[model samples]
Target: MTRDKHDFKKVVPFAFLIFTIAEFIPVLAYFFPSSLPRNVLTYSQKRKLIEKRDSIRIQIHTHINNSAKTNKGSDNAPLISQRDFINSTNARLVSKKYASSFDLSKTADFKTAKLMCKFFGLSSIGTFSMLKSRLAAHATFLRTDDSLLFKDLDSTVAGLSTVQLIEACDSRGIPTTNFSFPHLKNSLVGWVQFSNSFSTIEPGFYLWSRIFLLSKIPTTN
Candidate 1:
């Protein structure tokens, strides 16, 4: 009975901590409404999900182009030529199906996808579909200077997912942090965001980093 009481004492605070964090989410979400995805439809709703995802992509790109043109002359500004933008967008869509399949959970599937990506790179496929998608997403992103743009873009291009992102970054010689895309995506999705994202953060520090971020309550003075 003494041990049981002691265990209860230990568990109660942790349980309460989880409860507190859960309660805090809505309040945080309310203040940062734009940070949240517009909706959380189950993956089983394939048609509705595909429609929503497509609509969001169109909206984001349109916003990026409009914002880019307004800032055209700056040296560091988004100056992607109209022709490049059109070509990139088309190329990105071509690989969208493949990009969506680059999940790491199924090791065989991931290896096959990686080979296919490499094949596209070695072959005469125009724009190097996967890289082209990354560039298109990156360019659309360059046009906007929103503080939240990076995170929003992360969610938008999540179809590229995490393992692919790592490979993409490595192939292009981009610097990366220990942070994982799967960590961020799963936390954002409140469960998981497919195989790659889930596996990327599984039982790791990245997962804890997400929990820490979510646990904080924004203060107003």
Candidate 2:
């Protein structure tokens, strides 16, 4: 009876801690959006996470800084420039069925194929002749900017799914410590979407860094 009672005693504290973190904290956060509880990590763990975060943010900065090397306009550069890609008529003009059925190799499928060329660092996506080159360059990302971040990321932030956003924010060293999930997610998502509209790379980097800073509410204060 004593052993069972002792085990029960041991379990109760752990259960309470879990309840505090998993339930109580979120409840507190929902009510107090700006203020967040902080620093659930040990001092050493916090230091380590901070180091990792700083290292990755530096890498992101370096990647953004060095992105200007790949000049966009070559003689054979795609008629569909990267900035104009979303609105490009190349997609509307060329249909997959048409391209397959007819020898439309001469057509610049800018929104689709040609944009792929631009993204992959190819100087030309102007012809079907470069299909092999495009495929070969497929592994590369020429822009070296935040747009590449969005390539695999879903822009739909309304799903209320916080897992991937948390991972992304955490990896970016956004101090996943104490903010309400919804506000943090909203800040990051809204910043990304707003930054995405700019024709240049700087805005996206700037906006993302802003969110990262905002997510850095002190764990204690």
Candidate 3:
């Protein structure tokens, strides 16, 4: 009886090891979606997204460059208003980990905050209380983003996978719509390659003197 019990314990551990490995394969991931990280893509998923993006690079480059050139007529700036473009981007920009840090609140005062908002071009001529203006300002900063940093197209841009694209744009406030995967990929490629004196900020919020305050700093009345 003692010998039989010892053998059974060894067999149980070996079986569990096999079950754990099987549960993580691509096929099993679909069955147990909750087990996987919902946002980050697995290796196989990323590979597929890359293949799709590469297949349609030309369409992307042409469309973006042409669009930017046509938009930038006389003044070395894009015809699309900064506020308009940023507002149109997805609102779900901040990652959950970093979201708690966004201090868009009424605790901020009136005059100083509004001045900061006006400087960022986040409003009409004049706005209401500092609270509303600051919210608008924070949103605008989060939304303002450029495609592939408007770099030379031949260089290796468009390397991000689908989730990566979404996260990066969400982080930078780049405009992405309900377009198909291929169309979105194409648009990004073109947008990146085109050179522009766009006169618009790419990575925003870092310079927003109003939106984010260093939490560790002490404040006084």
TM-scores, one per candidate: 0.21, 0.28, 0.25
Q: 1-221 in candidate 3: lDDT tens per residue?
A: 01112124345544564578754556644453222333334655544443433333223333433554576647787533222222213112321223333334432445544434333323223445544544454544343333324444333335666765543332322333344555445444433322122333322323231122111111111
- State how far residue 129 of model 2 sits from its true place (Å): 35
Ranking by lDDT: 2, 3, 1
Question: Lowest summed-lDDT stretch of 10 residues in model 2?
Answer: 1-10
Q: Residue 102 of model 3: what lDDT?
A: 32
> Once model 2 is optimally superposed onto the true structure by TM-score, how far is the C-alpha of residue 6 displaced, in angstroms?
47
The per-model lDDT (C-alpha) reads 0.32, 0.38, 0.36
Instruction: List candidate 1 stretches off by more than 4 Å.
Output: 1-44, 74-78, 85-221
Error of 1 at 42 (Å): 10
For candidate 1, the TM-score is 0.21
User: Which one is best on lDDT?
Assistant: 2
Candidate 3 displacement at residue 99 in angstroms: 31
